[model samples]
Structures are given as structure tokens and as C-alpha cells.
Target chain A: MKTRLTGRVWKYGDDVNTDVIFPGKYTYSIADPREMALHALEDLDPGFVAAVRPGDIIVAGKNWGCGSSREQAVVCLKEAGVGAIVARSFARIYFRNAINQALPIVTCDAVDGVENGDEITIDFAAGTVKTPRRVFTFPPLPAEVLEIIEDGGLIPHVRKQLGR
Target chain B: MGKTFAEKVLAQKAGLQQITAGQIVTVKPDRLLTHDNTSAIAATFRKIGVARVADPSMNVIVLDHVTPAANETYAISHQATRAFVAEQEIAAFYDIGEGICHQVLPEKGHAWPGAVIVGSDSHTPTAGAFGAFAAGIGRTEAAAVMATGEIWLRVPESIRVQLHGTLPARVSAKDVSLYLIGLLRADGADYCSVEFAGEAINAMSVGERMTLTNMSAEMGAKNAVVEPDEKTLAWLAGRVTQPFAPVYADADATYASVIEMDTTTLAPQVACPHTVDNVAPITEVAGKRVDQVLIGTCTNGRLEDLRAAAEILRGKHIARSVRLLILPASREILQAALAEGIITDLIAAGATLLNPGCGPCLGAHQGCLAPGEAVLSTSNRNFKGRMGSKDAAIYLGSPATAAATALTGVITDPREV
Candidate 1:
């Protein structure tokens, strides 16, 4: 599935870990998308919750989610309505977690070019990213990786594999 | 082709003995665990339109990061986790008062030898202490595990860290681990399973082994595994319900790389500010001045760790200029320390005791550093701005070194203490 992100890009510096992604304290809050949404990036970027818009992608540097393998990190990103994340490098777990949740974690070297709020389109199938100013092509995901994303992460994929 | 730990584990889980590169091997996790920080993984299942977790008994959720509600936001987050656990019927939902996931998980026996354990936190690899090929996965991957109990991976290569010589009385496994981290650099073991095999490792207690494996993530390695022995089995008897046996790589087992460490004359090592790779002999930074000395976290917050710090703290008070926060990783750990009077001695000597949790480790609350302040911490991760302020400097060391630093108010060798 292809989705377009239209909000201002909320830029963050390097090593945005699970602690900063969703601080440990908020993990106990209600699963109501709004409550979970309110605390997104509360520690690293206090204004992140108020500043983000649905479908905005976060651009990060190497080793994104470097510390703590907390899954709440990804939940906060998804609940904050982040459509996709593009980074130069990602912690192994965060990379797979984002894709399995179908949150669209893509890797690109030119992330430094995309400023906050630059209207962009990420076409999963085309393996390309579009900014009004430039059309950037990303390396296509491997077939298996794409299959998992298309199946909406591992659960659905496993269900299909199991024919349940 | 030679198989890596990740390859062998995945192949077994996928019901196959071998899988080729570029092929998808859907791996069924033998155990799944997460803390409050990444509970969002279970939420990802909802986003993808799935229902209950794949298996309640096999999955566990823990509230570790924000223990005791450092802020209103923390309070709210804890509530969200409770709701998720109750709604999903996840059997092993450890609440805020429970303790750090890393310490409590192994204590409770969720991780077993030869199992493939996954978690949302990078440090999940600490389970490798049990001889499991444990790795950290992302929330979405965790969500997939929650929904279907499986995910795919490209098995990583293996790196053998061979240690020789006996550990000095003052030196513990933390010193050895820091020494290795210093030598290998933070990214030295990246994406590889670091197999620790040596007299020093086998002779160390399970607590020390856990401390070693717990910090494997600091080196950016997938995990650290010990060839489980009597010490491991003793601990596992009361905790693990699953049937298992210790698994070790064969003597002729292939490795992507090998690094040798000789500890006969090794001195106490310290990971200085900004990065865990920052290393220096504790003597070099001593008496420079310190603002805080934190003694807890998943890495080195157990009773034995606290005792090691307290033994050094006995008869010596923390410098008036230094604030020492002594947080055990769990309630049982706290009890052990208290029962042994370690906490009282530490407290009487000017150490502040906090609850058992992952405080200060993430800089969210408790023992944060101010700009220009320096802290000697027993916890893992010494990144810039990691504690509280970006300008603050952190020195990572063993509990003994951390205790010694508290007395001198800067990094120092325990031998001199």
C-alpha cells in the first residue's frame, strides 16, 4: 500500500531511542489512541505531540532507536500518526518492528535534504519517495520484506502462511 | 555455508534445518517480552487490524522505564500498559512496581536455554546469558510476534570473545565487560553474537554473567552468550519451568571474528563520557570531580552489584559534592541488599536509595545530570546528554569503580580505595 505524508517534517537529531520514542512512564497509560498519542516524544521533544500531523514522516540519522528495545517506541510513532520513517540507518529491531507494524520504515542517505513539512509521497511498490522539489528513488525492498509489509506485518503474513 | 547463531535459531523455529540467504524463514519466538517503553508493539497489532496475542503464556510485558511515576506523563503511560495487558490477556504483565524487565525476566524464568527470545528493547539480547540466541526486535516485529508469534531475520555472524586468566578480587565481570567494550569499541561487535568462553566467564557467578550479557547491547552486538554451567543451572532450577539444556558452540565452531582478552593483570576500566566506546583507566580520570554516582539499572543493579559497591563504600562516605543514587534493579534485589545491610551502609554513607527500576539509565528521571556535571554510573550507555543535560559528562564503570568514584568525586581505581 502507498501513502502520502503531507505534514511538516518534525526533524530530530541522531539516536532517537525507545526511551525518547515513547518514554517508559507512558507505557502504562490507556491504549486509547489519543492518550498514547499525547505523550509521543515527550522526553526528547516535548512539543512533538502537539507539533506532529497525521502522515508526517520523521527523518533521523544512524542507529535510530539505539537504546532500549521497548515496543512502545514504535507505538508512539504510529499513534502520533507518523506514516513513515526514513533514516540513514536503523537499529535492527526498530527496522523490523516498523515494517512488521507496516509503519513504513525506509532507509535513505539523502534524508538530510528533506526539510520539515515538505510534502512527500512514499510509494512502497515504486520504491520511490517524492518531494515537490525532487523525486528520490529508494532501493526497492526485497521480495520477502515487501511481502511481510503487504501482509500488514508478521501476524497476517503468518496467518496466510498457515492458511488459518 | 556456515551458520550463525541467528541462522541456527531461525532455522529451528521455521521448522527447517537450513535456510539460504535472501530466503524468508518465519521464526516462531520461544519467548517474547517487552517493557513499558515498547508496549507500543502490542498496539501495532491494532493498527494492522489484529486481535489478541498469539500466546499469552509465551509473551510477557514489563513496566520498567518509569518506575514510581517520575512525572504525570509517566503515570499516564503506566496506565496505558495496564489497560493493554488486561485487554489482551497477556499472562505475564509485570506492573510498575515489579522491576526492570531484564532483571525480572531471567529471575522469573521466561527465558530458557536454547530458546529464541525477542523483545522490543535492544538489550533483550541479555537473555543470551541463558545460552539462548536472544535478539531485540522492533515494536512492529514484536507486534507480529504478538499476533502470529513469528518474524523473519537474516541470521547474524558470530564473534568469539575468548577471555583468559583469573579475575582479581577487586575486579568483577563488569570490569571485564568494560575492558572488552573499551578494546572492541562500541560498534566492534555490531550485529554479531559474542560468545564468551574462558575460565573467568565460567568461574563467575550467574549474576556476573548476566551483567556481562546485559551490556552486550552497549557494544552494538546482537547478544552475549555463556556456555551455561552449574552456576546457571542452579539459578534456573527455581525459575525456569521449560525443559532445556545448556547449548554451547562446538570447539571447531566457526566465528566471523575472534578477540582475545587476558585479565590476569587487567586494571579497572571505565567508559568515559558521550559514548560507551570511550575508555580510559579509572586512574586517569580520578579526583577530577563528580556530581553524581548512580548505582543501578538492568546492567549492574543486582544485589551482588550493590554489595560490591557497598563493600567499597563501607567506612567511607560519598563526597559532599557528589550525590549517589543507589537503585536496585528489583524488589528482591532490594530485599537482599537490605537483609545484608548493604542498603543501610550505603544509605548511612550518603547514598540515596530509589526504587528498583530503569531510572537514570534512560535520563527520564532519577539521578539525571545537569549541564557540566559529571557522573560515574554503574548503568549502561554513556552517550552525550544521556543522563539529563547534553553538556553533562558520564563515566561508565564497575560498581567497585562507581563506589570508589563516589568517595573521591571523580573516576578512580578501586585498588587505591
Candidate 2:
């Protein structure tokens, strides 16, 4: 995983749950990861999928991804090429899912400092998010989680462990 | 410092004398649960190059989400899951119509005190009502567990909630859960192990305790538990044939915070539109118009919930403008409700009896809301477009409140009815 990266920001408010992140309607219907990306934020932000470029960051208020344990919520964002998600906080299961999917999830109070379309730089090793105005620091991801992310998610990591 | 329930349970599972919060440990879970998503998990498991599940007996598969195949896609998924279960020689598979995974797990003897359980669904913590340490994991990790039979976990900090006094008429455990969620927003207990205690909690039935632990997921809890008592033993007597020891917190266990509530002054609670934490008392939003009233799902779809709704709607028909839907959590719940004539009463009162499964709670099918419509549901979530159209609104409450709202075609206070 890249330790330092820059991206454009897509800002949102508190409690952006799984259903809105990846609508439940297509849950059973869509099986392909690429197709799942098309419906990302279809319910809440309809313009997101079509406009989101690879490496765009999502800056949101507290408790982002607060509902459902569906991994599709994480998959869609990863497939959409969202560089990282920096929120004030995240629901527990979502945080785990993000790591398993190798998606960067940073928890810190950076929502107020950044706005939509702002250019921001994230240094995972430094544990800092540098915005146009200020720099916000978050506790670094645990070493185990970083290892999983570095190995391209848990599936590949486990595969390596099993000598497959 | 003395250990909390989570620390104690994890310490035992890890074969250690003691463990503290915030430490990481790797342990084999007693049970691994997957529902309709089993097919997806199986696919991921195959990608890991595991020919067979490390231990098939540790797996419990349930087919409740969008059951009976809402379409060809869902049917194909279920078909694949069945094939995987057969290939893996998994004996704990529950086919369609059995029930929601959370309800089916404990009922079928998979969950017991001191068991470490994990599932692919967020409400997996419902099994914690039996004094088990149950938490939800994602599909990827669930696949990993299937392949390796072990998982890594971070010991969560504990939050102690003490409930005092007795609930008044028409108020139930669902109200208590909503009150707690409102008090501690959606992220109040994020990644923390929440323990329910005190007189009001001990007074609750196992089913009611299940409701509390089930909704605890909405507050971002890693898991939630109520201490196992004789009631828990009584409920599991026949189902659980194996002997097990129940774990408890130390007398002076350290906690991040302690909260206490008096149930006597509590009123019926409702989680309003867009968020589960955006909650209010029934009186605050009473009499609001509604197009539908859904009384089922993992959260409040048990026999007691049905009885509560039936008690309010016995012999009286629902409002013409409202569409009332009743779905029991499982086939067993459906059978028991049928035996008690609760089904007949609810049907006679103009409630449409959907099959026992997670109908419309996730908005996959059965009852999708149209634009500009509103529903008063007895489910846990009320997120935007959760029931169907983005413009549609979902207000969540207990079964009694759902029935009362269906009776008047508006969100009504159960006590007033």
C-alpha cells in the first residue's frame, strides 16, 4: 500500500450508513465488483459514481458507514477507487471491513478543515492528513492491519499464509 | 483491575489465565455464522485456495434474507449456498423459512454461555443475549475463519448499563433499547462491549434481552450481553444438550463508563427518519400520517412482539389508509404465534401475514415503499430509502406502537390506544 498519497475530497455529514454507501436494493442482484461501483452512493449522492475519479478521498463527519455488515459497502468504495476515508469516527464493523478490503480508513477530526474538491495529502506512515489549511493527525492503523493492507487485503494475505 | 465479561470470555477462549481490554488475541471461535451471504463468503473462501472448510461443524448457515428467492438472482445465490454447504459437509445449515440467522442460531442450540461466535451480519450480537461473546465480521474475514478456523480480535473496552425500576404499561424492551440508543447516539459505544445489568434487565425475558442485544448493533457496539440467569438456562434447557459454563464480570470490573436508567419514567420510544440515533418519545411524533406499518424483522419479530401487536389489534381492523404487514422472525415463532391464535387475530385485524423471514426490513422485496410515503416499522433501522424510495420515510418503534399506528393510519402512542 502507498504510504503517502494525494486526492480530491468528497465531503459528507454524519451517519452516512451502509445502505446509502451501497444501496440494499442491488445487494442480491449485483455480484460483480465493477457493477457494484456504479451504484455507490446512488441513494444519497447520485452523482458520486459517475464523477468520482480514482484516488479521490471521502471526508465525512462521525459514524460513517454506521449500518450493515455487508462488505459490499466497502467493496464499492474500493472499486470506485476512493483513495481513503477520513471520518471523525466509523462504526466498528465497517472499520474492520475496510481493512479487510485494503481500503484506507482514517479516524480523526478533519471534516471541518477540508471541503469538497479540496486537495489533501495523506501520509499513512506519518499518521497525518495535510489539508490546504491545516494538518490533522490520527492514530496510525495497527501493525497487523497495515500488514493486511500492505498484502492487498485479508484474502491475499491468508492465501500467502496458506502457501497457495 | 478485575476483568469485564469480554476480557473474561476472551481470556478463557485464548487459554490464558486473564486478559485485559485493548489487547489483541487469536482464538478459534466456537461458532461461525453466515446467512444468505454464505454464497458470497464461499466464493471468497474458494479464492483462498482452501479445498474444504477447516472445521465444518463450526459453521452455521441460514437462508433468511430475501428468502424463497425474490428473483432468479437470489434463487441462484441460495442454490449456490446449498451446494457449498453440501460440498463442505456442513450439518448446521438452516434452509429457507427457518428464520433470521440471529434467531435461528440460539434456538437451534448453536449459541450458549461463554461461546465465542462471529457472523457475517451486523446483528450477530443478538446471540450475546445468551451470555455468549458474539460479534459481527465481514464476508472476507468470515471466509478466512472458514478456511483457518481462527480469527484475530481486539479486546474491546466495556460499557456498563444499569436499568432500574419497572416498565410501565405499553412500554417494552424495544423502548428501553431505543432510549439507550438515543442517549448514546449511533457511535456512543463504538467498538465497545456493552453489558446490560440491573433490575429492569433481569426482569426481561430472554426474547426481550435478545431485542436489547440485537439493537445494540445500531449503537456501534462490537457486541452486547446480558448476564445469563435461570431464564437463559430455562430457554436453552432442551435445545442445548452440551454442558457449558457461563462467564461473568468481576465484582469490581473496570469500565470506561457506567450509565444508569430508571424504566418507570420511560415512555415509548421511536427512532425517526434517516437515522436510528435520531430518536424521540412516542408522544413527540404521535399522530403523524403513515402509509404502512411493518411489525417484524430480527429486532422485534419474536412471539412476544407478535403478541404485543395482537393485543392492540385484537378484533379491531387497521385503518383503511394503512397497509399493515406482520412477519414473525422464524418458522418456529410463526408456529407458536399460530398456536396462540395471535396470527389469526393479526390477520383478522387487516394485517397481511408475510412469510417468516426478513421481509422488506432491508428493502430487497416484499414491501418496498413508494416515493413520498411513510412507514411505522418495528424494525431497528430507519435510514433513508431503507424501505424503498428515497423520499419515503421510516419511523421505528415497538410492536405495540406499530399496531397502534396501523389502527389509526398514523403514528400513534401505544398507551393512548
Candidate 3:
């Protein structure tokens, strides 16, 4: 599976909670992927939906996506066509949920150097991020974990391996 | 190979002789839980036209939030949840004033020791008080669990927190947890189970242990569990409908890391603006002044938390500049606080008590802060705009600090009380 990613990084400030990722009230009527995509980051950034594109990533400081454990926060990003999310850190639940849903979550320090809209590249195997200004190294994933990301999600991957 | 809590629980529930970490396995929970806040996931099931819960007998829903209908929006949310539960014939549905989902689940005996449980609320780890191996999941995950009582878990590495010494007066479990958050930082236990051990943890009461394990989520821990003891068994004897043995960590358990704390030397630690990790000594941020002081939520919105706050606020009133909102986690807590005279005393001290529910913490209901206003709150998260206005500042601390700030209308140490 491919282990490299390059994208324009969207910069978000600290404590970008699940609510800001996916609003609450809109949750009542629709679970369609597009419904959340329309409102992604509406609370935090008004034009986030329009501004983002597929393969785009978000760079944030500590406690990124930290509020209530809502899966839609990830689904919103998924529908927003976010290819990978690289942050300094992630809330444990978001990290787990994002991985489970097959969203690429890369944690790399030196996100400050990767400005918004700057096309950045991530190499999951080498555990490094490369941009115009700097090359940021990250903690690499174990081969099995990389396989989990490669096969899409836990259930699908497990099903395939077991031939079920 | 050494087994993790996840491995053990999954193996037991899957009816397997052996299981490995890194392998795919399904686990049946002894109990399952969801609340009004995450009931939206069940709503998603309605989209798929899942007419019935995957397992009606095991599922439970508690409407702790939006209780008393803060407004029309929340009322509708609760109504939708009720519709789903009634349609599915889910036996464990809890309605208005049913108590914080965590507090009620164990107090009512649904949680059993060594039982693997899942809930939509992140603090479902609170059921660890009963020695249940409980963890929180998101709505889709909850929905998946609702569909199949099995959910996948990556066995987390374990971290041992061997705490020594006793807490000083005025320093409660909240203070101890804050101290741990400060020392360990938010991601200190990322993807790891924090096993609370040592003299201090063993000496703590069941409720206090629950308080500790409950907020391990704040530190991004996978689960925080205390090795059950006589206290846990005794706490369960009267409450549990079906008796169960308490689960204890192995005597020679392996841990990825170990943390030590002397509770006596710890003062109240406060998480400063915007992040749970931005912690510092309260003395550093005291007298910073506040526009609001909030005391309550799933974190510290119980009767004991209220009593602690009332003890600090009884003879004093908040400053004119501050608005103090005290919300009980449930109507039961409210009644207990009122019976203990804490509620009336809090109201007399100029504290506005809201009906039992998660109010300002979500910013969906009451007590939003205006721009430039600062608040000392006991709620779990102090993320920007979390309480309505993005421009407002939040300082996270224990209920005592929240109460002390309510009394002085500025941040102060509860030790002064």
C-alpha cells in the first residue's frame, strides 16, 4: 500500500474540539456523509467547507479534536475529502476513531513550519514530513499498524484476511 | 504471552480459549450504555432502518443531558432518543433526572466487576469503580456495538501510577486528578491503560476511585482502572443486583511506564486556558478574577462535589462581576444536595442552580460566557467557544476552586475556606 502523502495543510488553533469539527443540532436529521461535510468547521471557520479539498490535511497543536467523542467529527472530515490528518497530537478517541474509519492520521512535530495552503508531503514508512521550508521527521508506525491503514479499516481488513 | 485487560475481556466474551493482541476478535459486553448526548448514533440506525437494537436486552440509554428541556432543540433530541428506545424495546432506558449516566449505571447495579462494558460517553471509564473493564466509544462505534455487542479494541500498553501518601484537607480526588494531569500532561497516557495503585489509590474510597478513573479521558488515557479491593466489593455488595467478583491487576503485571505521586505535597492544580494540558499551580493563577464560576458536569457535578463547593461558598457570595452556575449531574444529586442543605446554601450564596444536566459544558444550553469574560469551571473540557463565545477565556479546576472563585468572584484557593 502507498505510505506517502502530500497535501495542503489547513492550520487550526489548539483545542479544535469535535463540536467545531461536527456541529450538534444538525446531527438530528441526517447521517448522510454530505450533511456533515456541508457544516464541517462551520463553528470554527465559516468557509472551511469551501476552502478544503480532498487530500488536504489539518495541522493543529495539542488536544486537537478534544471534546465529546463524536464519530461525525471524523466523518465530516472524511466527507470533506480529507485524505490525511497530521497534528502535533490528537485526542485519544479521535485518533482511535480516525484510524478505525480508515482516515490517515499522522502525528508530526514542527507543524508550525507547515503553513496553511502549503503543499506538504508525509512518508509514513520513513516517519518524516517534507515541505518547502523544512523536512520534519515523525515517529514511524509499526508495519502491522501501517497495514491497518492500508486495508482501509479494522472490520474490512479483518474480514479480508480471514476470507470472510 | 502476557495478556492485557482488553485481551482478557475480549477472550472471555468471545468464548475463546486464547486470544492475542494484534489479532481480530469480538467481545460481548456484560452491559452496554449510551446517553442523550450520543443517542444521535442510534438515530443513524434509524437511517439504515434497523428496526430493533442488535441486542435489546443488553442496551441502555440515559437521558442525562437535555433533561428538563433546556430549550426546544434539546427537547427534540431527547424525544428522538426516546422514540428509538421505545421502538426497540430497549429495557434499560433512563429518562429525565435519571442521574449522570455513569453514576446511575453502577449505583443501580448494571455494572459488574470484571465485566466488559461499553458506553458512548467517554467517561464510561467511570464504571471502573465497580472493576468493570469499561471504555467509551463514538456514536458509530456505539451503533456498531448496538448492532453487534462486539467492538474491536487495540490492547493498550499499561502504565502504572503508584501513588503514595494521603491528601491534605481541602484537597479531594479532583485535586489529585488535576495534579496527575499536570504531572503527566494530557497525552502522557496516550493509548494506554492507567492502573492506579500504591497506598494513596488503594486507600481512596470507591467514589473517589471513580472520580480518578473517570477523568483519565481528560489525559487521553484508553482506560483508568483501580485494582479492586475490599472497598470495591463492599461498595458493590448492596448495589449490584447480581453479585460478581472484583477484578484485580496481576501482582506481577507489566507496564510500559510507571508514574509516582506524593499526594500530600500536591496543591490544587488548574488547567489554564484552552487545553487540558495547560496546567499550573492555582497559586500562579489565583486572584486572576472571573466573569463566571461554574460548578458541575459529568466530571464534578455530583452531590459530594456540590457539598465541597457549598462548604467553600456558604458564608460568601460571588462578586457582582461573576455569574456562578451550579448544575447537578442528575436530579438525584440535586435532591441529595438539597437534603444535605448544600443546595439551599449554594443558592443563598448567590449561586444560580440549573436543573440536572450538562449545561454550559457543551455550550448547547445555559451559561455561555461573553467575549473577554473569564471563567473557572469544573467541566471537563475548556476548549475555546466550548461555552458559547470563542473570545471568552476558561480556566479549568476542581469544584472547590470553582466554588472559591464563586465566593471571592476571583480565583482563590479552597484552603482558605
Candidate 4:
């Protein structure tokens, strides 16, 4: 896992739900992770999949991913190569899903300073987000949660625990 | 200081005498729930090299989403789930037509007071209405729980909401929930354990309490509960025969925040398209055109909810321009409605009765909308494109509001009707 990530920001407002992140209609139809990436944010931002680059960060307002417990919502974005997400807050299930998928999530107010296409750096080691204008610090993740992420999410972590 | 309900429960589950908010503890949940997604979770479980589930009896699998196999893909998924259930000897499997996972879980006695339950669906918190510490988990973690029979949870700070006063006629628990969601906003109670109390909550039926807890997910609650009373015990008398202790917050429990509301004059509430918190009083959006009206899903699809709609539509046909759809949350609810003659009344009133499952609420099939059309539903969500075309709209209201709207072919105030 990368301790620091630099990416262009894709910003959004509050209540960016899973329905728009990965449309529910295609849930059962799409089984391939690569195929799932094609539809990320298809409803909320039609151009997201085409324009997003690997390691791009998503900056959003409060309550990001506030609907559904579909892991595909996180899987699609992770497969799309999103490096991290910075939001004021996130729905509980989505937060857990992201960690399980090894997608970096930061809870902070850095969204206020970032804009679309602006370069930002998330330094997990320092628990800070560096925007072009300013730097915002967030509380560091727990050691156990950080270990799960470092092990490339919960699946691999659990596999290692089981000595697989 | 006294401990809150969440603290008390987590502590007990962890085999500790005390625990505080924000501390992480690993405990074995009493039950784990999965719906149609059980197929995907089963695949992940295999990847973990676990040939057998740690505890098959602890798992509850239900086939509800996109039931009857909307297409071959869904059919294959359900088939795989059945195979997994058979192989694992999972005794708590509920096939299609059993109803939604949330509704089926408790009815089958999987949920009870003080139980720690985790599910792969967001509405898993609906079981909290039974006084369980239930929360939604992701598919991957669900697989891990299956392999390890343990889960790590962060004890959440508690929010106490006290309700008082009698609800006016034409007002219901759905209205009270909508009013709270509107007041709290979408993220007001983020990651908090919400506790409902006072005389108003005590007066509500178990189904009504379930509606409140189910809608709590909309406001980002980790879990929500109403303390178990004689009413809860009465509802679970035969279903939950096991001896279990219930947990409650101490009188002086510390809370993150406390809110109080009087429901005597609450009006029917409506959440507009695009966001659950984007709410308005029914009067504000009344007379708005609606092409369809739906009354079902885990949110408001209980027997009482159907009866509420039928009462309004009894001996009255819906408007010609509108299509009214009714789905009972479970086969049990369907049978109860039929026995009560509620289904006949609704069908005679120009409503289409779908099977007892999650029909069209997720937009996978059944009644998707056309662009520029608007539907008023009793479901929990109204996100853009939630039902069909991105350009279409979804409005959320109580079952009473849905019945009145179907009768008028537009959004209508239930009280006014």
C-alpha cells in the first residue's frame, strides 16, 4: 500500500449515494470488476469513468455514499483506480466497505479548499491532506484498520490470518 | 457516569464489565444476515480457503432482491445461493417469495432483544426495532465473519430521541419518521446509535417501530433501537422462544446529543427527489403530478401499512392516469392482508398487487419509470434514477399519502383527502 498518494480531485456535494456511484440496475448484471469500473458515477457524473485517471482522488461534501450496502459501489471505484476519498463524513456501511476494498478514505474539511481537477496529496503517514492553497490534518486511522488496508484490504488480511 | 445502551450491549458481547464509546471491540455476533447478495459473499468466503462456514446456524440467507429472477443473471445467482445453503447446511435459508431479508429475519426468530446482528444490506438496521444491536456490513466482511465467526466493531456514541404527545388522525409513524429525518438532515446522526423513547414510541406497534428504525439508516445511523417492552415480547412470543436478556441505557447514561419532539400536530411528510433529507410537508408538494404510486418495500410494507392504504382506497378507484402498485413485504404479510380482505379492497380500487418481495424498489425490474415521469412511493429512498431513468423523479411519503395520491393522480395530503 502507498503511504502517500497524489491525484487530481473529482469533487461533489453532499449525499453522494451508492445508487449514483454504481447504478443499482446493473448490480446483478455486472460481475467482472473491470466491467464494473466502466459504470462508476455513470448516473451522478456521466463523464467520470472516461475522464478519471488512475490514482485520482474524490473530494465530496457530507454523507458521501449514504445509501445501500452493495460492496460493488466501492469495488467499482477501486477498480477504476481511485486512490482515495476525502469527505466531510461518510455513511457507516460505505466507510466499512471502502476499508474492506482497501480504498483510502479521509474524514476532514479539505473539501472546502479543493476544486475539480486540482492536484491534492494525501499523506496517510502524516494524517494530512495537502491542497494547492492549504493543508488539512485528519485523525489517523486505528492501527488495526491501517493493517487491514496495508494488507490490501480485509480479504487478504483474513487470508493471511488463516495462513492461506 | 452511566453507560448508554450501545456501550452496555457491546460490553456484554465482548465479555467485559464496561466499555466506552469510540473503543473498538471484537465479538461474535449472534446472527449474520445476507440477502440475494449471499451468492457474491459465498464466492468471497471460498476465496478465503474456508471449506466450511464457522457456524452455519448463525447465518440467515434470504432471496428477496430482484426476486423471481428478473433475468438469467439473477436466476443464476439465486441458484448458486441455494447450492451454497444446501452445502453449508444453513438452516435459516428463506427462498424467493419469503419476503425481504429484513422482514424475514426477525419473523423467523433470528432477531431478538440484545442480539448483535450484522447483515449485507443497509436496511439491516431494521432489526434494531426488535431491540437488537444490528448494523449493515459489506460483503467482504460478511465473508470474514463466516470464516472467523467474529467481527470488530467500534462502540458508537448514543443519541436519545424522546417523543411525546398523541399523533393526530391521518398521521402515522411514517409521518413521525419523515419529520425526524427532515429535522436531522441526511447526516445528522452519522455513525451514532439512535435510541427512541418516551410515550409516543411506546404507543407505536412493533411494525411502526420497525419503520422508524429502518428509516434511521437514511440519516446515517449505525443502528437504531426502541427499548424492548411488553409489546416487543408479545410480538416475539412464539417466534423468539429462546431465553435472552435485554439491554437498556442507565437513567443517567451519557449521550452525544438528545432531542425531544411533540407529535400531536405533525403533518404527513414528504421527501423530494434526489435526497432523503430534502423534505417538505405534504401540503407544500401537494397537487404535484404523479404518474405512479407505490406502497411497499422494507420501509412501509407491513400489514398495517397496507391496511392504512386500503382504508383510504376502500370503495374508491384510483385515477385513470395513475398506476397504483402494492407489494406486501413478506408472504406472511400477504396472507394476513388477504385474510383481512385488505388485498381485495386494494385490488378493487384499481391497484396492482405484486408478489410478496422487494418489487421495483431497487429499480432492477417490475415498475421502472420513463423519463420525465414522477412516482410517489412509500419506500425509503428517492435518489435520482433510483426507480428508472435518471430524468425521472421519485417522491417518498407515507402509505396514506401514496393512497391519496393514487386516488388523485397527483401528490395529495392524506389529511385533506
- DockQ per candidate: 0.28, 0.87, 0.34, 0.86
Model 1 regions more than 4 Å off? A1-65, A70-89, A101-140, A150-164, B1-5, B19-23, B37-42, B48-51, B87-89
Q: How high is the lDDT of residue B25 in model 2? A: 91
Worst ten in a row by lDDT for model 4 chain A: A22-31
Tens-digit lDDT track of model 1 for B1-417: 466555566567788967543455667787888777444565566755656777878787888877787777667667777888888777787777678898888888887777888877778878888788788876556665777766666667778887899988788888888888787766567667788888878888888888889888877777778877888888889899868855556566568788888888888888886667678876777666788888888888988899999999997788888899998988889988889999999998999988888888777777777788988898888765567776788788889988988888877788888
Candidate 4 chain B least-lDDT 10 residues: B166-175
Error at B383, model 3, angstroms: 0.9
lDDT of 2 by residue, B304-356 (tens): 99999999999999999999999899999999999999999999999999988
Per prediction, the TM-score for chain B is: 0.96, 0.99, 0.94, 0.99
Best candidate, lDDT: 2
Model 3 Cα displacement at B163 (Å)?
Answer: 1.7
> Scored by CA lDDT, what does every candidate get?
0.76, 0.94, 0.77, 0.93
- RMSD of candidates 1 onward, in order: 4.4, 0.8, 3.6, 0.8
Which of candidates 1 and 3 reaches a greater lDDT? Answer: 3
> TM-score for model 1?
0.83
Which lDDT tens digits does candidate 3 get at residues B1-417? 556555565567778876654455557777788887545776555444445566887787888755667666667778888888777888888787777788778867788778888888778888876677888887756765666556766666778888899987777787888778877777777777778888988877777787888878877787778877888878777777775666566566567888888887778878887777788888898889898888888778877788888888787777787788988877777888888999889888899988776677777667877899898998777766777777778898888888888877788988875
Cα lDDT of model 4 by residue, B1-417, tens digit: 899989999999999989999999999999999988888999999999989999998999999999999888999999999999999999999999999989999999999999999998889989989899999999999999999999999999999999999888878888888889989998888999999999999999999999999999998899999999999999999998789999998999999999999999898999998888889999899989999999999999999999999989999999999999998999999999999999999999999988878898989888999999999999999888889898999999999999999999999998877
Clashes of 2: 0
Candidate 2: list runs displaced more than 4 Å: none
